[model samples]
Target: MHPENTNFIYVNREMRTLSNIDYDITLLDWLRTNLKLKGTKEGCAEGDCGACSVLVHDGSNSEVRPINSCLVRVGQVVGKGVITVEGIGNEKKPHPLQTSFIKENASQCGYCTPGFIISGISLLNSNKDVDENSINDSVSGNLCRCTGYSPIVKALKSVGNNHEEIKPIQFVEQNNDVQLGLVSYHNPINLDELLNLTNKPNFRYLAGGTDLNLQRPIINEDQNTIINLSNIKELKNIEVQNNKLLLGSAVTIENFLVTIKDRIPELIELLQRFGSPQIRNQGTIGGNLCTSSPIGDIAPVFLALNAKLNIFGSNGRKKVNLNEFYTGYRKNILTKDEIVSSIEVPLPKKDYNLFCWKLSKRYDQDISTISLTVYIKIRDQIIDDIHLAAGGIAETPKYLDNLCKDMKGQKLDKSISLAINNIKNYIKPISDIRGTADYRIESFRGLFRRLEKCLVDGVKTMSIMDYNNE
Candidate 1:
């Protein structure tokens, strides 16, 4: 514990500041044990169950979004505002969402009702006219043992359509721009303070804590000295510079979608299935890439787009292509001292054809069984450039450069046949829980065939949402 430092986090309407706090403690544990806010239940310690859902607002936008508390570290929300179920409404003054839930008989065992209420209220706070799809996606992370979703969905729609907009609790300004300190828990505000702490022995860097929290004692154990990278000013930027989209690695997935949705809608549609709204709120693009999961949703798209990542260490910074960053499954070329600073994506030309697909057991909040992305630039019905990447097929997400090369200079029909035959050279899928090796390979072949038909039909983009609608 560092006696010299004082950390502050805002919860409900109060500013809770403490000195020498443990940074690695899960926010759900703190809410239940320290604050004794029993309203926020804990069903699964992992992020799968949404019983620990709460509304969190940061200084960037002050817009409250629902996130699972069990997967968040206390240090990550030091300067942000958190609202639990208790803060939503009390017995004396019930929120409209609460009243709707009561009227619609949405509560079953009642264990998951608080989290569902928080999701409903947050949905109302953000969107006044949500459709059925939006309502379904909002509560995708929550799991109800009773399996009573019809009434819950009805309650959410009722609140979304009829409830009055309640003003969220205002955030308190905290001084987060302090200099570096030799503390067990570090919340650096600027690049210098963060860089200075990077090379220290056993110093672990944390972003959204969604994935890291699941690893528990392996990644962010109680005694480890952790540095919070979420609030650093340098890593929270998104800009277009020099004909490339430069995105900070620490940008939230939700924020990333907001910033680049217009430029790449097809990719955003695939990302929408990355996790539920709650998981995306607490997950970062950098964290997603750094985790180096073979089934990660964003890596295949970025690899196909020829994206590069900027890495910073105590010495200086270096940029590496996304295809070259990964060494193996759950392993990257990053040294112990280096951290990802930003991601650089070369903007595609106007005539480029981009497509991505995700196959999972469930439509929402599930990992990919097989993910594929294709980027092609054609002129006069002749292929000028092509890049393909696949996930959940190998130890790392890999670009099919050999296949792309084989398809170069060929017509759309000819390239289709070329890709189908050479696809096996690039990927060697293994049997796993999601699917068998033969199934994934067949799906890859089928995807190529469908891609050919879509190209022949003059399709510009392909999205699961669009496909479902069709």
Candidate 2:
């Protein structure tokens, strides 16, 4: 351990010094190339494949969570603890899960076993139930081409929940800027410090970094200054206030799902389809909105709920509705100096009937071709109020205020299909690689047609994919 150099991380329970590391250098590359720890394989570098998964224990949370090492930068884990496959065990003193994998023949071709083991370790570290569904869900992000995943699930089940526990460590605050050779990695402790650093040229706010890191340039490609917002306490909270759920911009998508699962259980399906386990663990709710992707999964549901965004800048804080936040494709109303602090979603009334869906080619880890959310308030079996929002059917995630209003006071019958046709005038979708414009339009209309079957007939087939032992 280098006491003189305060820049180091706990790699496998040992402090390793970091010196002159490249800015664009990912933790995967550093582990495989620099440290010679090639156990963490690289499959799809964009974080879809969990071959590069690892367990990281940061200062923000006491629990060790699984993250895609390919998407994590070197500076992000400064002073944190990282546990790779080597950290788990060896051939002589194999960990319980590793031994179980061998006994049950869970690993084939031996490529994705390390990541699955790491994910299993993370699952056991937590207090989750050791059952068939939980075991399947824990490794949903990991893929095994040779082994049909039944063996993997069996291995985890055989071992049960008694995992080799990771020793707890004290967390010290490291909120200052990190200076590499050609990169300036800024870590602002508070909102004011974050706003002041916004003046730096070529600046970008790093929230979950699930998107930005994928599109960032390579090492020494340009002198870029990136700021990490995960350290700010004001932007990482989850609380309920005055009948509204206030979700901080920095709250992970997984955390959001856990917090609102009981309150708004209807949204659980859509958020579960949002991404795999690793993607959900790293991507934040704010990053999903700020990206303003036309195919984003978070926007449609929030729009149907009429969420409000709290923005802050040097001038002061301001509130803007979600409908007015996006101006065009991937463009939002935020200025260079402003940052979204949190999202305010009003709790619905008891009569609220919410429906959310995302149409995609695959059941998991695929982009949305058409995402829809329809919220209806029922009064005496008639449609008292209605709100609809959709994505991938326009230049931006659109709110069908006028079209949904046309269905107000109408019975929840097939006659409402006439009003649903008006969505053609509101949306301006174009053809692309995902689907053609006509396909999107027709499919968009089909969601409403199915909506009737859902609300009236009580169908449970909307995005229905679960980790059940069928």
Candidate 3:
């Protein structure tokens, strides 16, 4: 058992909150076991399934975002407001999304119904003008073995089309009575307090809990005290400075999409494919980088855009290029006492051409088999400068620096063919379930050909059929 003191919050709601909890139990378990909110199912213990979706509000003026409770630690929701499906509506009056689902016969076997309803409601509440494709992409992580997607899609579209002025459910504010389960945990309101927390040993920094919660259980259990950075106001900001865009570590993918969708449309597509609505709403850009998965959907985009990360610790702040951040497969240069405070991406120039593509067997809710991102600038029909990166081809998301160097100053036709050939030589791709080394290599060549055509034709066109089944 763990010792409880000023760190733990005494939950006063209708549930019994545990104190000094050992054994990293998830927020989903806390809801079902302690809170008796069994309406939220545990379809998958991992974060992949959206069955345990919930809305986590920081008690600030910012909008609420959906999260997967299965991976969230029970202690992480201390000061924040957690809204489960039970909190949304009662038997007498259902939530608009819930009502629409029933009317459209969206629930078959009813296992994934609550999750779909919660995700749909979150998306619609966030944006009333949600399109059908967005709706489909938002709920992609939710799986109904019964194959009742048509009605679910119908229900979501109906809510967006018909319910334009639906007011969101208001929960009682409990900021004054905020209680947490742990003592050493710090929920800093400012940057100074957040930086102070980093001075301690055995500190686990948390933002969105998309990646941390899953890997937290096996880390350091003895001195493992988590520093919840979600409440830091400075780290939740998004602003443009000079010619660069800075995104705070706590800025959710859903929020970032709204800010830069028009400016970087290709990035918007990548964000849509990052994860499901619940994951995107909860996952932080910092968390994505820290995960350091070779197949991370966001890393390639950051590489192509030449982004920089601002990391803060006891020693103060430091910056690192996104390309150099990843040291190896599932490895990073982050220190235990350090936290990624923000990410800076430069605005593309007029002549800059950017493209990103993810090759996966399934379009939605599947990891990238081989992802590639290219940023090229051409002058006088000669390749002036080019940045190329590929994921799932090596241990780390590596920039094809040597290959790009080989192709630079050459014509697009011969240079691209040489670049493709060089990639086959330089990259040591491994055969995984998603694809083989040969397949990934060939796919990269094909992508190079298509990208070269786009550059030559001077047409920024994307195949609608690429994202559509029909």
Instruction: Indicate which candidate wins on TM-score.
Output: 2
Ranking by lDDT: 2, 1, 3
State the C-alpha lDDT per candidate. Answer: 0.81, 0.82, 0.75
Over all chains combined, what TM-score does candidate 3 have? 0.88
Error of 3 at 145 (Å): 1.3
What is the Å distance of residue 80 in model 3 from its true position? 1.9
Task: State which candidate, 1 or 3, has the greater TM-score.
Answer: 1
TM-score of each: 0.91, 0.94, 0.88
Which pairs clash inside model 2? Answer: none
Q: Look at candidate 3 and give me any clashing residue pairs.
A: 7-182, 7-183, 8-180, 8-181, 8-182, 9-179, 9-180, 9-181
User: Better model by lDDT, 1 or 3?
Assistant: 1
Ten-residue stretch with the least lDDT total in model 3: 6-15
Where is model 1 poorest over a 10-residue stretch in terms of lDDT? 174-183
- Model 2 agreement with the true structure over 47-98: per-residue lDDT tens digits: 8779999988875456888899998888787778888999889988999899
- For each of the candidates, the C-alpha root-mean-square deviation to the true structure, in angstroms, is 3.3, 2.5, 4.0
Per-residue lDDT of model 3, residues 79-164, tens digit only: 45566777667779777778888899888788777787777767776754678777887788788878468888888888775553
